[model samples]
Target: MDHNIILFRLYIIIALCFLIPLSLLVSIQLYSLFKSYALTYFLLNFFLNNNKVNCNNKDYDTLFILLLKQQRFFLCISSVEYLLSLRYSELDPLYMLLAYCYQNHNFCYVAEYYYLKALSCSPNNEIILSKLTQVSSKLSKHPKLYTNDGLIL
Candidate 1:
């Protein structure tokens, strides 16, 4: 009985050690999602929810990056815009985000532009080059939103 109790206690300790961090991370992710969505709500309501916890640029950026990595382009847009407005005085766009958004929106040529711009920042990146090639190929193969006297062609 004593040996069983000792083993049970050890198992509980190990499980709690793992679960505590996992739960904390999950809660933080949930809060980040809620806070980001709150920005789209009424201004007063946004402020009310925002006042509960002040997240800095890094926190917002991390969440934004996570959303982008998840291929949640539309969701990340608000986060990117918020991060840009907060950190940059002139509000410079994140080229990667712009490329992802445009590509998702079916603006292949425009996405190619931003992807090229992003490639300039990371010249040797295979991912950026691959995305650029993909978008460029798409641009050449399909009718764009504007071409040939404002007609899709």
Candidate 2:
């Protein structure tokens, strides 16, 4: 076999093994994920109502939810893609936003999870600590029941 033919075979193998998986991962059905987020904010009106960020208030959380609910899958996907590209996984603000959404929806367990994630990113945060305490106290004896949404405690 010629050198070029060997290289071509290697390229094909690489493409099949790597590129295909990469594309599969990147081309996920984002709308479905957004819908199945188990939180509300997948509506156009959510973002349309608030664009301000008030950490002390629920505005930031609501704003993010609204942004996601706006049905702008490409925009949402790109924004998250940029964040991932920058390796920004443990951002407390992101966690806090999600936590608030869960809390607001009465998914206390999920909210607690995100609150802890936020605390890990930014320790000594009074808001998060306070939330953690509040949510912790509200945790039921059942370890898996979060809400009446059929989720296991």
Candidate 3:
């Protein structure tokens, strides 16, 4: 009976050794996911609020960097679009962000359009010019590859 109790205790210790690390890993993942979701929600609310004029470019830049780091291109595009709908319509950076998001999604034509818009906003911007040239060449190389909606066929 004493031997059986010792074996049971050993088994419990082994189980805990495995379970503790597993539980820690799972909790870490859950916490990371929760943080990501909370940040996304906050960003959505920040962009959607009507009183955006009170916010500055630094705040937008920080949010843009965060969205990019998270690889949330759709949210980045939507947020830039909302900003453009406001007084930032002529902002070259907003156009550039939109172009980049579309390019990442393989919408080369739409990307080219926004790149051109960005270039129009800042005619001397070498980066926008280079991106436009690249997208233009891509479109030329595969003229029939994308449908009217700019999705690859």
Candidate 2 lDDT, tens digit per residue, 39-135?
Answer: 4444223433534321232543354555556554445434433443555544787667666666766888988998898898889898998787778
Q: On residues 5-62, what C-alpha lDDT tens digit does candidate 3 reach at each position?
A: 9999999999999999999999999998788778777866866776555677777887
- Number of the top lDDT candidate: 3
Off by over 4 Å in 2: 1-86, 140-153
Instruction: Estimate the TM-score for candidate 2.
Output: 0.39
Candidate ranking under TM-score, highest first, comes to 3, 1, 2
Best by TM-score: 3
lDDT value, candidate 1, whole model = 0.66
- Give the RMSD in angstroms, all C-alphas superposed, for model 2: 15.1
> Of the pair 1 and 2, which is ahead by lDDT?
1
Q: lDDT per residue, candidate 1, 1-153, as tens digits?
A: 999999999999999999999999999999977875554344324433663335544554555555655577775666555545554432323767778887988988778887877787778877887787678777675424576678543
Which residue pairs come into collision in candidate 1?
Answer: none
Q: What is the lDDT of candidate 3?
A: 0.82
The TM-scores of all predictions, comma-separated, are: 0.43, 0.39, 0.69
RMSD of 1: 10.8
